[model samples]
Each structure stands twice: as structure tokens, then as C-alpha cells.
Target: MKAFTTLRTTAAPLIDGGKLMANVDTDMIIPKQFLKTTERVGLSEGLFHELKTLADGSPNPDFVLNKPAYKSAGVLIAGDNFGCGSSREHAPWALLDQGITCVIAPSFADIFYNNCGNNGILALTLPQEACDVLAGQAGGGNSVFEIDLERQLVIGPDGAEHHFDYDEGRKEKLLKGLDNIGLSLQQDSAISSFEAQRKLATPWLEKA
Candidate 1:
């Protein structure tokens, strides 16, 4: 998980990316069959699998992801309550594998937000009006966006900026590429000292 600083892209605008899209649960992002593998690398194959493909396994030309403009999209401006349903860390993994680093939406499922932090994905929350504006811009397919996590700002194609809010600690963790395990490990020395004292006080515990 690399540190997330900024996402600058001049690629096609990410229009219709669920601005009206609702209830995009974990299963909708990646189907159950894709869950068979613990490895994250190949999960992109299943990202929006149902929407991106037909029952015959052919690419759905009408889907947003299959469109040529979004083929290389890095930032996803999404709709309200975007990541709903099951708590699957694989959801963000699949998105990242598909080259999407950030997902900005009106709201998100709580568990999904936590999973994103753990895996180095940026899940941004903004007002619905702001998201609608971004969606309109992206729908045009010619807009660009610069997402600066360090500054907590989204620079639109028109040079207008939208400020967002997030926990200061979580922001630092993303900027420093620190997951929960990494955050915990920061206290390794203190934890080790406590363990050493515990062993001294209860020698039989160490024997076990």
C-alpha cells in the first residue's frame, strides 16, 4: 500500500459513475465467484463483472467501465451511499487493481470506509450538490480533476475547488501509507516493554 498523496488526471471525465447510481453493494462491485481468490492482483477481472459483461461472457459495450474513455480512469466520482452491503475489503482491492485510486461520493457505508483506509484507497465524502456538479462535468467526458489528499481539496476541471472533511488521523495514515497494522506497530517498543514485564511477573506464563 503506497502512501496516497495526490491524484492528478487529465483523462476523460468520469460521468454517470453512479451519480444516480445507488446501492452499489460489495456484491455488485465484485461478484461472489471472484471471492474464491485471496490474492488481489487479478480481481479486476471481476470488477463490476455483471455490469461489464453479458451472460455470454462478452464485454458490455454500454457499461461505463467498458467505455474507451473510462478504460484508464483513475478517479471515480460516485453517487450517494456508494459502497453498501457486505464488508468486503476486496471491493477496494478490485477498484485499485482496475486503476481506480479514489472514489468521491456523497456518502459511503461505514465498514466500506474502514476497509478503504486499511487498503490505501481514498474514499472521499462531499455534499450531494458538489458531487452532482462533478458528475455533470465528468459526464461530458472532457473534464479533469486533481484530488489533493494532503490539502483535503478537489480541484475541478474549471479550476474551482471543493473542500472535503475527514478524520485527521485517517488522513495522516493515508498520507503515510499506514494501515491499522502499521499504526499498531508504531507502538511496538512500548508493547514489547509491557510484555517483558509481564513475563518477569508471571514466569509460568512464558513457559506455556
Candidate 2:
């Protein structure tokens, strides 16, 4: 997991005009076909495959992610109920591969939100109006949004600050680049001590 403190980059909008696209499920983020691999690196090829591809198998030029200006976007201004279905961790993996480190939305599915934090991606919940404003700015082209996780602020292109709330424990883990495994390792001494005590108490079990 990468430490996430601050990110200053362009934002991509998953909005249509003033309305944000709702109920963007994990399958929509990365379709079933892309779930074959356990490795996270190459999943970007399947990120939003259905929406970004045409019937003829060509890239949809109209898609916000496919557009020239947003090709390198690092933040996503998404919709309400984003990441709404399935408990696939690959959704955030694909997003990370596509260079999006943070996602802003009005709401998110519980599992998906947890997965984002576990995988080092920031899933922010802001008011619907605030999301709409950021989406509008992102859709306007050549806009840069700065996300300061330490300060819990999202600075829009026009310099307006939008505050967001996050779980303190999750925030600390993200800031320190600690995943579940990493967090577990932090209790190494205690774990080792317990193992040693168990081994001494159950010598017959070890022999068996």
C-alpha cells in the first residue's frame, strides 16, 4: 500500500452535465472477465471496459476517461452510490492502475469503501452538492484538484475548500501505508510471545 498524504492532479468526472451517474457497481468498474487474475498490475486494461468501449471494439471517444484532457487524471469525481455492488477488491486495483488514487462521491457501498482504504485508495464521501460542483469543474477541462488527506480537505480548481470526514484509524493506516498485513505485523512481538507460550503448554500437540 502506498502512503497517501497529498495529491495534486487533474480530476476526471463520471458525471453527465449536472447529474452524477449513480449505482456504478464494481462489475462496471472492472467487468467479470478481468477478475481472472489475482495480480493487480494489468487490471487497468479492463477498467470501465464496457463503458469506454464501443460495439465495434474501439475506444469510445466521448467517455470522460478516454478524452485527452482526462487521460492522466489522478482523482475521480464520481456519483452517488458509487461502487455499489459486489465485494471485489479488484475495483480499486483497476482504479489504482489507471492512475486514480482518490475517488469522491456522495456515497459508496460499505464493502467497496472498506476495500478502498485497505488498498491505499482514498474513498471520500462529500455532500451531493459538493460532488456536483467538483464534477462540474472537472468536466470543464484543464482543471486541477488537490486532495490533502492529512488536512481532510479537497481544494477545487477554483480554490474552494471542501471538507470531508474519514475514519481516523483508516486514515492513519493510509497515511502510514499500512495494509491489513502491515497492521498485523505491528503486533509481531505480542504474537510471537503468544506462540511461544502455546508451544510450551502443548508440547504433546507439537509432537503429535
Candidate 3:
């Protein structure tokens, strides 16, 4: 897991992810064609692929991500129920590959939210009103936004801040860069002790 504390980045409005478009699934995020390979490389090119390019593979100048200002965007401001389809964790992987470290939305799909936590992406939920404001401001020249995990606040490019809440367990794991395995490893001594006791109790089952 990547340690998360404070991050400041240029934001890109996730205009078509699941809102403007009809149900953006994991395939849309990474596309089915790109799913065969397990390697993380080349995943960035798949992020918003359908919208970013044409059938002939030329760039769509009108898309938010295709624009110069948003090319390096690390934060995405999206609409409600973002990541609504498919439980594949590939969606977050694609976003991370493209340098999107934070996603601000009114809501998110359950599995996608957990996947993001496992993979070190910040999924921040704000009211629809707040999302609207952030989306509108994100395309401007500065497009900068700051996310502070410790303070649980999102600082807008204009310097105004909005507070957010997250589960305490997840928060601790993120702050410490712990994924599921890492979390379990934190109780290594306990697990080892339990295993030792179990082996002793079932001695007959042990292999020579």
C-alpha cells in the first residue's frame, strides 16, 4: 500500500465515468480488451480509452482528460454512484496507472471503494452539492486540490476547504501503507502463537 498523508494535485472532472455516460463499468475504465494481461503496465493508456480516443485511435480534443490542463491530473471529481458496475479491482488500477491518486464523488460502489483502499487510492465522498462545486472548479487553469487524510479535509484550488469522513480502521491502514496482508502481518506474534498451539494439539497430523 502507498502511504497517504497529504496530497495536492491538479483535478480532472470525471464527467463521463458513470454520470454523463450510461453505466461506466470496469471494462470502460480498463476495457475488456486490456484485461487479459495481469501486468500493471499499459493500464494507463486504457483509462477512459473510449472517450479519449476515436475508433481510429486519434485523441478527442473535447474530453476532459484529453485537454492539456488535465493531462497530468491526479484527482478526479465524479458524480454519484461512481464505479457502479463490475467488482473488478482493475478500475482502480487503471486510474492509479494514470496518476489519479484521489477520487471525489457523492457516492461509490461498495467493491470499488474497498478495492481503492487495498490499492492506496483515496476515495472521498462529499455531498452532491460539494461534488458539483468541485467539478466546476476542477477544469480551471489552476485545477489544484489538496487532500489531507489527517485533517479529513479537501482544500479547493481557491483555498476553501470541505471536510469528509472515513472509517477509522481503513484510515489507519492507509496512513501506515498497510494492505490486507500487511494489516494481518501487524498481528504476526499472535498468529504465530496460535499456529504453534494448533500444531502441538494436532501433533499426529504433522508431516515427517
Candidate 4:
């Protein structure tokens, strides 16, 4: 996990609503069967194809990102309550694998938002109208966006900006790349010291 202070990058518009998965469950994105594979390439080759495509193999163009503007969208400007659905960590992994580092939306599902932060993805929530404006800009010929996680601002190409807020603890975790497991590991020294003290006080407490 790395801290997120700011990110300025090009925008690829994914305009479809209600179909795009956010903070998706990892299992659904890449089943266990594909988990152990050594290669990290082609993760996006079938990403959402099964859910958003047809049997004959043609793309479900109706899907938000099937359009040309969104072909390789790296920053998703999404809709209200984005990332709402089943709780799955794989969802964020799939998005990250596809090169999306940040998501700007009006709102997000709690689990999905947290999963994204844990994986170093900046999930931002703003006013619905603000998101709409950003989405529109992304659709128009290679738009650029600058997101300063530390300052909590999303700057658009035309110079307009939107501000957002997040939980301080989660922000710090993302900044340091510390997930729950990582956070616990950070306490190793203290935990060890506590165990040593307990052993001195109660030697019999140790397993025989």
C-alpha cells in the first residue's frame, strides 16, 4: 500500500450506469481456478465479457465502457451509489489490473470503497452533478484529470474542480499501503514485548 497524495492523469469515459461493477468481488472477476496462474497479463481480456456480452461473441456494446472512448479508461467517472452489489475484493483487483487507479463518483458502497482503498485505489465521492460534468469531459476527446488525494480535490481539464472528503484512517492506510493485515504487522514489536512480559509474570501460561 502506498499513500495517495495526488494523481493527475488522462480520463477514459465509462458512461454506462447500473451495469458497471465497482469494488467487485475478486472471486467473481477471476475465479479461483485462475488465481494461481503465474502470469499477470491478459487479466482484462475477459474482464466483464461474460457478464456484459452476448453468446455469439459480440460485445454488449450497451455496456458503458464498450464504446471507443472507454476502451482503456484508466479513471472511471461513475454514477451515484457506484460499486453497490455483492461484497467482493476481486472487483477492485479486476479494476486495478485493467489500469484504473482512481474512481470519481457521487457515492459508493461501503465495502467496495474500503476494498478499493485497501488496494491503493482512490475512490472519491462528490456531488452527482459534479460527477456528471466530469463524465462529460472524459467523453470529449481525451480529457485529463488531476486528483490530489491529500488535498481531496479533483481538477478537470477545463480548470473546474471538485472537492471530496474521506475517512482519515482509511486515507492514512492507503498512503502507507497498509491493509488490515499490514496494519497488524506494524504492531509486531509491541505485541512481542507484551508476550515477553507475560511470560516473565506467568511462565506456566505457555503450552507444555
Best model per lDDT = 2
Over 4 Å off, model 2: none
lDDT winner between candidates 1 and 4: 1
lDDT of candidate 3 over 1-208, digit per residue (tens): 7899999888888675434332456666777787777777678888878888988899998788888888788898877777877787778988998888898888888999999999999898999888878887875547678999989999998899999999999999889999999999999999999999989999877875
Clashing pairs in 2: none
Give the runs in model 3 whose Cα sits over 4 Å from its true position. Answer: 16-23
**For each candidate, what TM-score against the reference?**
0.92, 0.96, 0.92, 0.79
Order of candidate numbers by lDDT, starting with the best = 2, 3, 1, 4
State the TM-score for model 4.
0.79
User: In model 4, what lDDT does residue 179 have?
Assistant: 81
Candidate 3 achieves a global lDDT of: 0.84
Candidate 4 per-residue C-alpha lDDT over 1-208 given as tens digits, one digit per residue, 9 for 90 to 100: 6566777776754453632234433454455544455454566655565545678978886665566756666687766676766666666777777777798877788888888988889888888778777777775447778888777789999998788998889888877878888989999999999999999999998966
- Expressed as tens digits, the lDDT of each residue in 166-194 for candidate 1 is 89999999999999889999999999999
Winning candidate number (TM-score): 2
lDDT of 2 at 208: 75
The order of the candidates by TM-score, greatest first, is: 2, 3, 1, 4
lDDT of each: 0.84, 0.93, 0.84, 0.72
Q: What C-alpha lDDT, on a 0 to 100 scale, does residue 106 get in candidate 2? A: 95
Residue 161 CA error for candidate 2 (Å)? 0.9
Every candidate's CA RMSD: 2.0, 1.2, 2.2, 3.8
